[model samples]
Target: MTITKKTVIVTGAGGGMGRATVEHLLEAGANVVGCDLNIAALAELEENPRFKAMKADLLNEAAVQHIFAQTKSEFGSIDGLANVHGIAQHATPIEDCSLAEYRKIIDVNMTSIFLTCREAAAYMKEQGSGKIVNIGSVSTTRPRPGLQAYVASKGAVESFTKALALELAPYQVNANVLHPGPADTSMLGEFTAVGSSVDDTKKEVFESSVPLGKLLQPEDIAKSVKYLLSDAAEMITGAVLHVDGGRNI
Candidate 1:
């Protein structure tokens, strides 16, 4: 199947998984608009004619709505969306976690995706086709004590994808999630143990988690998302594509 030029919106595109997804989607010949709260990171892509980066806080529903409005104005319509923006905890123990922190994760990781899908689905329904790709975690089904908010948010993401898929199926709008093992991102370094500055030990732990004995890369996750947005996955929806080197299995 051939996938032609399409309009795609990638959230959290300032960097990390969002950065990787946009790169792959653009490489696949899609025009991209990325929403990110980091203005500088968003500005870095200003040189690309096919890539437009908007600095907006997805955690704010109004900001999410405005971002999509601008997205539609930029390109007549959006054909795909990659929900790669999410946040992890600061490694505080469960008892030490604050209500504020929990709310922050829920708003950014869960609520933001809901707003994106809701607004995107409206546009896609009119176009009669669209793709939604969400970034989920292996921790949804697995346990990670210090990451309570993150885990809960991902669990919601899985359910949200499923529910949205069933509702959009008649309109040919597909929603799916991708769960990836640990990868090297700026956020990863921040979420590491207190002692070490580098990510060697962190990488080692993730590599050890999977039978593959290596940490998965952003490109690895991007590849799976690319497939889901391609015509190859035309018949697929509500699938939680696992790109964790068999670790989540």
Candidate 2:
């Protein structure tokens, strides 16, 4: 799938999956505008002429709006969006999970996408075509214990993306969800239970859950993102594409 001359906005571009997606899109000749709170991580891609790094808080409405505006101003048009910014829920039973913690996860994982997608939809509607790929989690299908908050947020992402697909189809804008399995990113360690050993949980719990017997790499998810954002997936809106290694089965 090729995205030559396309302008795509990638949120959480500082993170493992987001960075990989930005790189892949850049390699495909897309004008990539990467946004993340951690500007330092985005700096790594500054050397690429096709890549533009914007440090912005996804949760902030103004920042999100500014990202879309700046991206359009820079690239002349917005062709696609990859909503990859999200946070993992720490393993905690419902009784121990605070309302604040739950809302934080929802805000980051779900609400941020809402803000970004809304902005992109406006721009794309005017342009008459666009593609949007929201990153979800395999846990939305194969739920694990103590991830209630995270799973709920991902579930919302899937539903929301589907809704967008239907709403935007007439406008020629496509929306879809990409559910990745347990990825071997630095954030993986943050999902460990309070009293659990991070290493042990990774090996015995996370890794073992994937039938493929290994963690999904960042590039694996990136490849799927590339397809979803390309012309090859033009008819793939309202779909949930799982990049998981049989984990949902």
Candidate 3:
């Protein structure tokens, strides 16, 4: 499926999955605007004529609005939004987790998507057509201990995406969520419990949990995003696509 002239905005563009999605979209001949807190990582993508890299804190409402406004002004229309920006919570029991830590995870993972989706929905509704793909965690379905905050945040994302899908269907806009398994990304280290060995956790826990016997790569999730954003998935909305190496099963 070719999205030759489509315009898509991807958050967390500097990170692994985000970068892969941006690259894949560019390869498909789409105009892509990628935003992330780490602007330096987006430099290589800037060399592409069809790619625009923006440095913005997604939690800031003003910054989120600015990105969407700039995209509309530059591209004249927004065809899709891929909410790939999110944070993981370190493994800790709910009682031991601090309020600040919990709130931060919720804000980054859930609220950020809300901000972007709200803006995208308004634009898409006006145009009467659009696509939205939100990145959720496989943990939502297969819970891991000591990750209460993180799991809860992703659960909110799944529910919110479904609500958006139903509400926006009349306008021909589609909303869906992608639940990824244990992805082998830098962020994987961040999910380990305090003082736990990241490498050991990867081998003994994460990798072992996947029935496929390997962790997911960034491109694995990107390919799924490509299909969801393409015409091939026009009938798929409010669906949770688990690209998780059978982890959900």
Model 1 segments beyond 4 Å from truth? Answer: 42-44, 193-200
> Which pairs of residues clash in candidate 1, taking residues 3 or more apart in a chain or in different chains?
none
TM-score for each of the candidates: 0.93, 0.98, 0.99
* Best first by TM-score, ranked: 3, 2, 1
Clashing pairs in 3: none
Candidate 3 structure quality by residue, lDDT tens digits, 38-135: 97888877888789999999999999999999999998889999999899888898899999989999999999999999999999999999999999
Per-prediction CA RMSD (Å) = 1.8, 0.8, 0.7
In order, the Cα lDDT scores of the candidates are: 0.82, 0.93, 0.95
lDDT of 2 by residue, 1-249 (tens): 779999999998999999999999998999999999996887767998888999899989999999998888888999999999899988898999999999999999999999999999999999999999999999999898999999999999999999999999999999999999999998888888887898998999999999989999999999999999999998888999999999999
Q: Show the lowest summed lDDT stretch of 10 residues, model 3.
A: 39-48
- TM-score of model 1 vs. true structure: 0.93
Stretches of model 3 off by over 4 angstroms after superposition: none
> What is the total number of backbone clashes in candidate 1?
0
For candidate 1, write residues 1-249 as lDDT tens digits.
444578889987877778888888887888899888874766656687888988888877888888778888887788899998877776567887789989988888898898889899999999999999999988786655578888888999999999999999999999999987777676666555456555575656556777777777888988888888888889999998888777787
Shift of residue 38 alpha carbon in model 1, Å: 1.1
